[model samples]
Target: MTSLPEDSPPQMSEDDRDTAVQRLQEAYAEGLISHEEFDERLHQVLTAEARSELVSALASLPEKHPGTTSTIGAAGGRIQRHGVWRVPRFLKVESAFGRVRLDLSRAIIEHPVIDIELQLGTGRAEITVPRDAVVDVEGLRTGWKDLRYNAPRRSGPGEPKIQISGTMGFGRLKIRHARR
Candidate 1:
């Protein structure tokens, strides 16, 4: 067999290809790419032979905002997030007399570690994390109610770790791992 050139582009792995596909899907959902463009780019990402080819397919997509925190607050209404929405690295959620439910089973969480700070008053908050996630509630403080969470038997290597903190007033905070 012939040796490859030194200047050749690096070969794309399955994980790289999967990440490229997820980027294209996110761009399409955000209306950054039209149907035709999404289809074309998706084909390119799937068939990409090198990392450069995959990069070209994902070119022009805006990078995630660094050092920016996403906040969701409700005074008396419910707050919910599920499906394939993007999950930022830092998230702050506040609800006063409102129920908060966050389902991150199918979320696009690019960060290996996510920090969620919650401030709630008199309303229950439920968070369903990814199955492989390792949750840390050490910084969470509760008044008049206990946090309900059963730690997993074991967390796998390289799985995302979610750090939840902040205060809860007169309302229970429940955390559960999503089922496979």
Candidate 2:
């Protein structure tokens, strides 16, 4: 990993190029990428196209180790769960500018109440709730024109409803709430 200043723009150094090649090799070995395709893509990564693609791919990769809090938005982004361990629960998610991923499939709420408030400058946001959870949406403004919203089906819900209300902007917002 090439250690660059946090504020530095996304540019690949010699070390970064080597790291990308290494990852590509690992991916090929893991069957995620074919040897031939990996060689072709590796060439591309060493060229100009690698700049944006590599940065985006790296950004989307999940954190390797757990319990490692990211300082990217350590002060502004948080997930607060308030209630007892019952069939129903209340979850409030608040973010100034960042992306959020929620999995309600593993949740054991009899009744689920969700409230979301997002102030996204140029970030992405996502929310996933049980299909039985009621959904309410509002207040979305985007700085750019490429805003996206995806609402899928519910996976599992013993007996819970979901409610959502919020405003969004030029970013993205996805909600998979219950069908109430």
Candidate 3:
């Protein structure tokens, strides 16, 4: 079989094309891309006749953070992270029984959004976020005690959004914004 010209677009495998489509979907779902942008990128991916075209479709999208998750666990005691610390993109906190406290008031948060996943068997968990931060706990599932968080009347622009998710078997979760 005769090969095409050197400048011709290289062929893309089905798996590669599917991966590009999935990436575009994720970017749209994460609010990284607008509906119109997703549609455009998706169209480019679907109709791309070459590898370079597929790459262009996903060129500006950010890759998923790898090894950016930090897990903190306690079997039956107190677990706490306070004071000045560097927070990861994703944090998983697990405690079997006892109190857990995470103070992000003075922590270094470099991301626009961070996720804190809590899996507690019993006891209370308290989280203190930055004064300008917004918290979203809609993904959290609790057994008895409901989450306690008093949202501000309005949030300022450019503040980070903290997403707290996962299951809590028992005990209360109190989230408060920093005073200073």
In terms of lDDT, which candidate is strongest? 3
Cα error of candidate 3 at position 68, Å: 0.9
Question: What do the candidate models score in CA lDDT, each in turn?
Answer: 0.84, 0.48, 0.86
Clashes in candidate 3: how many? Answer: 0
Better of 2 and 3 by TM-score: 3
Model 3 scores a C-alpha lDDT of: 0.86
Q: Estimate each model's TM-score.
A: 0.63, 0.37, 0.70
Q: How many residue pairs clash in each candidate?
A: 0, 20, 0
Could you give candidate 1's per-residue lDDT for residues 71-165 as a string of tens digits?
A: 99989889999999999878999888889999999999987778799999888999999998999999799999999999999989988889898
Determine which window of 10 residues in candidate 2 has minimal summed lDDT: 66-75
Global lDDT for candidate 1? 0.84
In the range 16-114, model 2's lDDT, one tens digit per residue, is 666566556445533565677777767766774435655543343222233221222322454333223222233334566556665565555542343
Which regions of candidate 2 deviate over 4 angstroms? 1-90, 138-159, 177-180
